[model samples]
Target: MPALFVTGTGTDIGKTYVSCALIRALKTRGAVVDAFKPVVSGFDPKDAAGSDPARLAAALGDPGGVFRIAPRRYLAPLSPNIAARLEGETLVLDDMVIDAMARAAEVRDGLLLVEGAGGVMSPLTDGETNLDMIATVGAPVLLVAGSYLGTISHVLTALVALRAANARVAAVVMSQSLDAPDLNQTAQALIPFLQGAPLFLAPRGESWDAGALADHLLTDLRAP
Candidate 1:
C-alpha cells in the first residue's frame, strides 16, 4: 500500500486533528486509509487508555482498533521515553518500525497514514527520538506546523531535521490550531512563512467538513 507519515514541530500542534482530517478526506475519495500513532502519551479517562492510538483509531473508524496497526502504547502524558519508563515497557525502535511497515502492508491497496509522537526530536525511548523513529519507518513525511507564534521557525527547523535524517518530505501542512482575530492576516503570511511549501488551513472543530483540507492535500500529494 502507498503511505505517508505525519510529524509535527511540537505536540498539540494539531497532528491528530490534521491526520484525522486527512484520513477522512481520503476516505471520501473511496480510499481506505489507515492511521497509526506509533507512540501515544496522553491518557483518556474514558478508555482508561492513556494513548493517542485509541483516539486515532476512533477518528479513523477503525473497528478492529489501532493495536491492529500500532504495537506499543505508553500511559504517561510525557515524552514516549518518559512514558515508557513510567509504564514499564521499553520503547523498542526496531519493533515499532516493523509493526508500522506490517500495518501498511495489511492495507496493501490503501493509503496508510502514520503519525509520529510529538516533535521530530522528541524522545521516543531512552536514547531514541521521533526523528530516529521516522528513520526506522522510512516513509515520506507530511510535516504539520501550527498557525501560531514562532511557527515559521518551527517549520523550518523541522524541515532541517527531516533533511538531516534523510526522510522524504511529502509537504508541509500549516494547521489552524488557534482562533486568530485576523484569519486573513495569518492566511496571507502562510505561503511565505512555509518557505514555499503549500499551506492549508484546517477549519475549527469536527463540525466542519474536510473537503477544503482534502483538496489541498490531494493537490500536494499529486504534485511532482
Candidate 2:
C-alpha cells in the first residue's frame, strides 16, 4: 500500500481532521489503513486524555498493538523543540523518524497516513523542522489548507516549500471548519487558484465518512 504524509500551512489547520478522514476513507475502500502522528507538541492538562494521538486512536476504533498506531505524544502544545525543552526532553530527529518509519514498515501492505506536527517550517528541534521529517518518510504529502481569507498565499507558500524539499504534492484539501467569514467565495476561488492540482472542500460538522472521502483522496493520489 502507498504511504502518505498529511501536513498543513500551520497548526490547527485541520491536519488531524483530514488524517482521520483519510483513514476512515481507506477503510471504506476495503484497505487496511493505519495512521501515525509522531512528535505532537502541546498538551492540555484538562485534556490529559484528549491528546491528538489518543484522539487518532479513537478515530481508528482504538485498535490494539502499539507498533503501528501509537502517537508519539509530546506535552508542550508548542513546536516540537520548544515543547521538548519545556518537558525536559531532547528532540531526537533520527530516533523519532526511525521509530515512525519502523511502524510504517510493519504495515507495509497497508496505507500508512503519517501526520506531521505544525506547519511545514515549524521547528522540530534546535535546527530541524517538519520538512526534515517529511524527507525521512519520503512519502507524497497531502497539504491541508484551511479555508480562510488569504489562504491562497498560505497554500502557495506551503506549496513552494514542499516542492523545494522535493516532496511530491498529492493534492490539497481545503478544510472549511476554520471559521472563515466568506466561506463560499473562498472555496470557489481555491479550485482555479490551484490550477489543475485537484482540490476538495470539507464543511464543518461533517460526519467523518471514510467511503465518500476516499474517492477524493484517490483522485488526488491518482491511485487506481
Candidate 3:
C-alpha cells in the first residue's frame, strides 16, 4: 500500500483541505483511497457531523460519516497531548502508529492519507512532536504550507525538520491563507528552496487538481 502523511507548517494550515481534496480527486480517477485523521483535539462529540473526522469520512462516502478514521477525539482545542490530559486520557503514540500501519496494510494495493495534527513540530505529547509520528509511520510526506506572512520561513523550517529526520517529502502544497500573498508569488519564492519536491497550490473555492500531486507522490519523490 502507498501511504502519504499530510503534515503542515502549523495548525489550520489546510492539512484537511488537502486531504479531502485529494480523496475526491483520487476517487474520481478510480483509485481506492481512504484517509485517517488519527487524532482530533478540538472535537465536540455533540457535533460529530461537523467535525474534521466527519468531513474526512464524508469525503470517502462512508455511511454515518462521523469519526470513521479518527480514533482519538478530545474536547480542548489545544495540542493533542494537552487536550487528552485534560480529559483524563492519554494517546499512546505506539498504539496509534500500529493502528495507522494496520490501516495502511489493509489498503494493500490502494493509497492511504494519514493526516497529522498541527505543525510538523507541534507537540503530540509533551515529549514528542508530529515529526516524531511521521518518522515512526515512515510514509512519504505531503507537506502542506500556508500562504501567510512569514510562511516562507515556516515552510523551510518544516522541510528542515523532515529532512533532519531523513523523511522523504513527496510534495509540498502552498494552501492559501486568508488575506495572504498572491499564490504564484509565494510559490515562486518557494520553488527553488523546495529542493526538487514538487509544489502545488490549493486555492480558496477552487479545485486543487491532485493529479500531479498524486503522480509525484506515487512515484516516490524524494528529498535531497
Best by TM-score: 3
- Give the TM-score of each candidate: 0.86, 0.88, 0.94
Candidate 1, pairs of clashing residues: 43-50
After superposition, candidate 3 runs with Cα above 4 Å error: 63-65, 221-224
Q: Rate the local accuracy (lDDT) of all candidates.
A: 0.74, 0.74, 0.85
Residues 7-81 of candidate 3 have per-residue lDDT tens digits of 999999888888888888878878888888778899998888888888788778994755569889898999999
Instruction: Tell me the alpha-carbon RMSD of every candidate.
Output: 2.6, 2.6, 2.1
Angstrom error of the Cα, residue 21, model 1: value is: 1.3
- Per residue, candidate 2 scores C-alpha lDDT tens digits across 1-224 of 45788888988978877777777777767777678877776756466456667667766787442324544556566787887787778888888688777877877677678888888888878888888889877888888888777888899898888888899877788887555856667877767766566676666653845455577666555565
Instruction: Pick the lDDT winner.
Output: 3
Give the range of the ten consecutive residues with the poorest summed lDDT in model 3: 215-224
Model 1 spans with C-alpha error above 4 angstroms: 44-51, 63-66, 179-181, 193-195, 212-224
> Could you tell me how far off, in angstroms, the CA of residue 120 lies in candidate 3 after the best superposition?
0.4
lDDT of 1: 0.74
Q: Report the C-alpha displacement of residue 152, candidate 3, in angstroms.
A: 0.7
Error of 1 at 125 (Å): 1.5
